[model samples]
Target: MKILKNILKIFGILGILFFFWAAFVYFSFDKTEFLKTFQSRYSKVLYDRNGELLSVFLNQEDQWHIQAREIPQRLKIAVINYEDRNFYSHKGVDFLALLRALKNNIFLNQRTGASTISMQTIKLWDKKNRTYLNKLNEMIQSFALENHFTKEEILRLYLSNAPYGRNLVGFESAILFYFDKNPKNLTWAQAALLAVLPNQPGLIHLEKNKNLLLKKRDLLLKKLYDKKIIEKDIFELSLKEPLPHFKTHKNIAPHLALKLLSEDKKQVVSSIDKKLQIKFENKALEFAQGLKQKGIQNLAIILADTQTYKILAYVGSQDFYDLENLGQINGARAKRSEGSTLKPFLFALSIDEGLISPKSILLDVPTFFSNFNPQNANKKYYGLISAEEALQKSLNVPFVSLLQNYGYEKFFYKLKYFLDFKDEDYQKYGLSLILGTKELSLEDLTQLYLGLANYGQIADLSFLRDEPLKGLKTMFSKGSAYLTLQSMKNVQRFGLQNYDKTKIVSWKTGTSYGRKDALALGATPRYTLGVWVGNFNAQANANLYGVSIAGDLFFELLSLLDRLDLEFQMPQDLFNIKLDLMSKYRYDERLGGAYTYTLYPKEAKILRTSPFLKRIYEFQGKEVDSKDENFKDAKIQIKLDLPLNALDFLHQENLNFKSEKNIKILYPKQNLNILLARDFDKQKALVVKIANLKNEKVFWYLNQKLIYEGEATSRILDLKPKIYSLFIISESGESDEVRFEVKQ
Candidate 1:
């Protein structure tokens, strides 16, 4: 009895001494070093709006650090129940567990570790050689950490630094790497599997030791069940749950993910709808694959919300892994010619300025302004077409003429100021501006389309969740925008007249010169989409055209959106007015009159009546004296061979008409072909008449040769049976020529 008492007293004294030593060490330990000692390199994570994991950006060491708040409550309980149940009750070190470990090692001849969660965290903070002294040091620092932080903070520190298999550290990286999901959204079984990973990360290979991992996970789950931490049903279900299969971590939206990650290691929430993005990506891939069979290799798409201007889907390329197609390039951002895609905006501008209305007549015939002569896409002239028809047909000649009428300087200013076009772009592309000669990114073009959908308001796009909504600027008046959209709705694929009405898509298609790029831009009441299909290498493919390629893909994507039920509401500011068609027509009695009425919106300021309607007459005959009784009541019919505008100008000036004698070709006019082989020419001498002759000698030349000379009101020229270039010259140096083919 005395020996027992003596042994107990010595142990009591040693325990007191150890307690005091631990207190002294805890006080002396530098707690500030605990935070600075272990700097975890975290991987950047991108999440969707639903807190679903979209992608993960791995750090150099393949770790992801997360905050305590980000840790799910269920995961916290699973980890604590499996790793350290007494984590919260104990300060830092659990002496009871330590004694139990010592007893197992000594008497039971078994090895067990009793390191508390706090102590493990301290060890992770300052890795040291495994020795008695190092363990002592860890215990001391663990106590110090307990004094400095709460239980949750210490647990977070453990989780942030904990290592899982395959050199991946932290709960975020490990769970995401293994399960392909965010830790917060992990299933109970998944959480249990992750709880046992840190214990044997290096040794428990997923393939080689998967069963061992499963066994250990089941055991931990049973412990939870026995302790009532988890229900019996959950425990049984978890036991039957299969271990997570290893999944290759993918960086979806690689370009955008890398760009966001480059700035910081923190998790970023993007407004992108991952499901929609995946759908668009798949469609782009499928489309590109179909095109690749025809040597076309790349496609990009952008879908944005009309109201908020948020980009919901963005596919930079068909496939990021396709190196041969240069699929890594973000084709959505690359600048290329937009072809006739810009015509709608130009027409809108014209309509907004009240220069033209949707029904205004625009000449689509061959036109020349300065040295620039633009031809129609099909090289066919449609003499007279309405403004809406011109835009629907995408007639280049009409838009070029409209742009010229709008004045290049004003249009350039509007493009620069309203749409943010650069000055260099204006200088680079001149009259071809309406033809999309200047290059623009898909992002910019989509925003412009958004403006059309939003009653002419343009706003910048938002990608990040917390980004402030940009203010909208007026790009076009509500009336003009509505009219433009109305016109675009009429545009449809050839032979598919009712497709637009069925789809209700206000869309436009563009094929850049040489067929290097094909684009389709469309908008519903709620969404705007832009698609580009072409070779990323800028190789021209004749098979690729706007309506055939990009437009087809656009409609396919639209079907995925399931927004066909939506409809565009007409703006309240627009009015429908009916006017007399005759009031708008220009009437000229001469030169084979062709009359078409011009229409204008009710709000449009009337500039002037159609110049073609004004009439001016020029009569050529013997001079008539006003005093003569026969000429007093005479009404002379005259023919004017001048431009309509010139006649309008002459009428506006109220100029008096006087008959003058001159050497002029009355018969066989300019560009007229006279075939002598016919009996008509054989019976005629091809008489050439002159007005205001003033007794001047007239010289007639055939193919630059003087064939006849006479002073008369009319001269006749007879030539041998042959093709002749005939020229009639007056002594005043005025001359006219006609090519006549004479055949017997």
Candidate 2:
């Protein structure tokens, strides 16, 4: 009875101590199964109106990962078979497998792994790398993990916890690396291949060592076959299968992905219009290939929706793919400058300052700055053209003139405020901003163009769709934006402004000395294009300057986009002045037939000319009452006695009605003089000679638009106020256009 009593006491003490030990382990067990850095680096993603991803921004220094459920079953099964076959039936440690491993390591003289799949998982999740204390901690954590998770859950943890190589630490990434597909659709053989990578990843990179990969694949197949996991025939088939040549799209910014992958845990939907993306890619590829055929090896292209500032497609290079190149890279991560593509913004600024209007004249002449005289593209000037003409033709001199006209500091301040750029940012590129001298990037260029496309508002360029930020602003006014758009259109003019009018294309071409520094910034009603063609090192200089070459390609691509309803919704807010002129003064009977007058800007009525031309000499008829300074309500009816059947040239391009083919009527002096405005220094009194009835000749002066046909001298006629060129054309096919401005 005493011995039995002592045995009971011993059992009680062991039981009590065991209970406390178990409780201690449970309390101290690490609940953290895995430590993954926050998924993204960027705070938010940029999306289009349709919620398409324009670009993903990240600032991380690690690999991107998908979740366990995000992976495929093939990978799951492959990982289990290769790493832990008894994962489904075992607790924290597979006792039977452990016993066998211990026997092999301690007695059979081999370093057999006693650590269960759970232990490996624990190490992956909570413990640090190889060390005695780490191993012990892994054991404790693994045991605790088993206490809470089921066998199946443990298997899942093992699958997700395992490192897939290349700093990608899970089944989510293993699938991406080897198969290029998500884990769910992973092939059996591909899964087997991923299973083999755990032993040694780098040596098995088939690109460098195909033989070694085949060896590892064969070993995996043998292990599976011996275990009866796969049929004999399946095992043999797997061994015979060759490695799929692995290729990857360079993760230009993997960190960018985390910031863009999700918004508030909701998976990101991109603002990337895929349809537009395909169109742009196909077109860019076609051009890049064409250039390659001609010895140009690379092309960088970006397609964006101008209206919403959504980046639709971007092809950094022609088949120029990589996996790890990030930061300052397009084709393999080399960033470059964005040239004349920056002009529209400056032009936009000009509009906001009211220093110029779309119709205001722009001079393409020699414009001097601090010892810098930027000339027209070809060092030739196209005399006094509208602001619209200067932009379409990409006249540098005129842009500089505008900058000078509107205080330079104020102009830059406008730019900085609108673009959210600092003074330093502008000083770096703005010195030559009047010219295309800024070394910027494709992404930056896209942002600026996007602002223009967004009706003068600049939206924050983001990679993530969520996360509130304040970056959007009306950098310029609607008027400025509208004017800028008009300027980029295919204008009706001479020289480089000439483009196929039928295409509805608006483009600005830019080039620097190096062939590598060429860019064509253009946009249509649908898309904006920024193409950079260049190389790394100094090769970019020459390779990039081929904008004209790229412009041809750009139009070719734009043609592929579905034809949209791009008809001009005429500017409703803008008002215009219209003049209805007539060459005919003679009536069908005597008082000249009544003419219908429909003017564009219904505001203009009285016939007005430049202030200088407002002074008319004397009347041709002595029988008529001469006009006076009080001719406020005065009206004059004059006649021209020309031979019948004589053809006459009428008003400008769209001719006005023929009031009477004989005489022109003038409004009262007071009313007419109100609209009189001009450049008095340019008004030249001309002489005209007219031969009347009975061979009598008289001399009179008249305005050019109202040429007397007869040699008239010393006469003035009311003409439209605009810049005009004096073209003296004789019978021969020769005429000289001498430019002169009539400001009225």
Candidate 3:
């Protein structure tokens, strides 16, 4: 009895001394150093919105040491049972296991190790020669670590730094490397296999020691089964499972991972939806196969939630491994010609300024703004097209004419607030700005469309899952945005026409000059997506038109995402207005023209009559009012709008237009093509006529030579087969000119 009391008292003294020692170690240990060591090296990991692994960036040593919050409970149990059964009961050192190991090494002449997971974690932090002194140092450090960190945290630190085969430094890395899955997905057999790896990582080579690894893994499973931690059927099934062989980890969302890594972020929880990103990548690759035959080597796509501005999927290129196509370039951030994608914004701005309503008439004829001449895509004018039709057709002449009316400098400043541009870019692009002479990125274009989708509210795009939607500013009025989107809802592109009408899509296509860049940007109520297709080298190809190439892929990707059964809510500020069918402006009953109802902005300027519309009556080749006595036999001819064109020309020429001209040309239309026949009977002389010329005398010049000076309403002159410039000047210094071609 006395010996038992002595033994118990001696152990009590040792236990009290050890407690003080641990307390001293915990207080004296360098916590900052441990923190630095913990944070110094970790494989940058990227996770999708749902916590699925996307990609892992290797550290400087080419090893994957990813930090994780927790491991699978099964894995933790397997590890605890196999490595340290008393892991929870002990402080940091298993004294009984150490004593048993000491007895075996000294008396049984056998080498044994009894380091707990905590001691092994210390060794992993600072690799030192295996000796008694070093082991003692690790034991002291483990005491500090155990006192400072929670049990769960200590377990995490152990697994995060544990070695599992080549270049894999964590259980998370091991699962991803060996099983090609996240740690949370580990099965019973897989968890046991990973748990046994850290003890003998060097012997984990399957070719030579696979049987040895199998035996150890089965033994761990047997222990788990006996302890009731796992069922008998699981142990049997685990024994039947084959060992995992070495295989390369597949990268997910590599381009976006690289982009995030460039900002020096080691871990990223991105806004990407894993399923959506995978679907987009597969579809983009499939879409690129067809484009490759046409020399379009690469393409990129960006899809985002319209309201949140969260980037859901991003494909920087069709294939990241295609070296021949320079597929590594991130096309989403690449700056390329904007093409006609910007025309919708111009349309929206035009509506906001009250310059034109959706159905308002705009001249699509050959237009000259100073030395710059803008032509339609088909190289043929529609005479006069409605503003909605002009936007839907992407007619360059009509948009350029509208921009001219809206003022180029004003549009430039407005766009510069969101799109990337300098002060000099406006002067450089001028009227061609809306025609796609400007350069922008797919990201920028996507953001612009997102703004249009979000009632003209522009905001910065979010890549991280938790990032707040920020930098919102109004780009256009709600009424204007609704009207613009309404105009774009039914574009006549190849695939868009057959789209489901209930879920309307508003989109625009753009082809840069020389077909160097093809782009499409659009928005539904739920999503705003942008697609860019072209060669990375900026090579031009005839097959690179936006509607055919980029737009095709855009619809394919759109179909991949689930469609929402929602409709765009119209802005309350929009109201119905009766517009004259002929003039396409605010209806005036005095004009005696048919009218139709169309939506227009309430705050927008209402044009009672189109600037291009004028009413006149003539009697006996002379101007006459309706009150004139000879009005019964008066001649009626609709004189087209030419005075407005002349005034616009004067503005472009910077000439004074203090007083408007009453005399307007009526014959030999601007940019006319006259075919003079070879036969004299068939050939007719070109006739020149004027309107509203009551008492005004005018001079007619052919190629700068005066041909006629009179107050007559009409004159005839024989012209040669050549390009001729005709000019007319009234007595008040107001002048108009027309360029025509005569062919024999």
lDDT of 3 by residue, 575-616 (tens): 888877775787766655567988887766664467665556
The TM-score of candidate 3 is 0.83
Best by TM-score: 3
TM-score of each: 0.75, 0.56, 0.83
* Candidate with the larger lDDT of 1 and 2: 1
**Per-model C-alpha lDDT, please?**
0.73, 0.53, 0.82
Q: How accurate is candidate 1 locally (lDDT)?
A: 0.73
* Model 1, span 1-744: residue lDDT tens: 999999999999999998898888788777665565544355567776556666665566544554333677877888888888899899899999999999999999998999999999888777777788889988887878888999888888888888877767788766776777656678778877778888877788576688888888888777778879878777787778777666776556665665565533357787788888888888887877789888899888988878788888778889888888787898888888787888888888888675577776676754444435588777786656778998988899889988988876677777666567655546556788888777888877888899888878888777776777785788777778878887898786763443435567788999898889989998888789999888878899988888878888888888788666677887667665442243222233342344444333444444333433333332344434566555655545333233332222233345322323344554444444454433455553555443423446878777887767877545666656666676777778877666655555
Residue 675 displacement in candidate 2 (angstroms)? 45
Which pairs clash in model 3?
Answer: none
Question: For this target, which candidate reaches the highest lDDT against the unseen true structure?
Answer: 3
**What's the distance in Å from true for residue 28, model 1?**
12
Candidate 3 residue 679 Cα shift, in angstroms, is 35
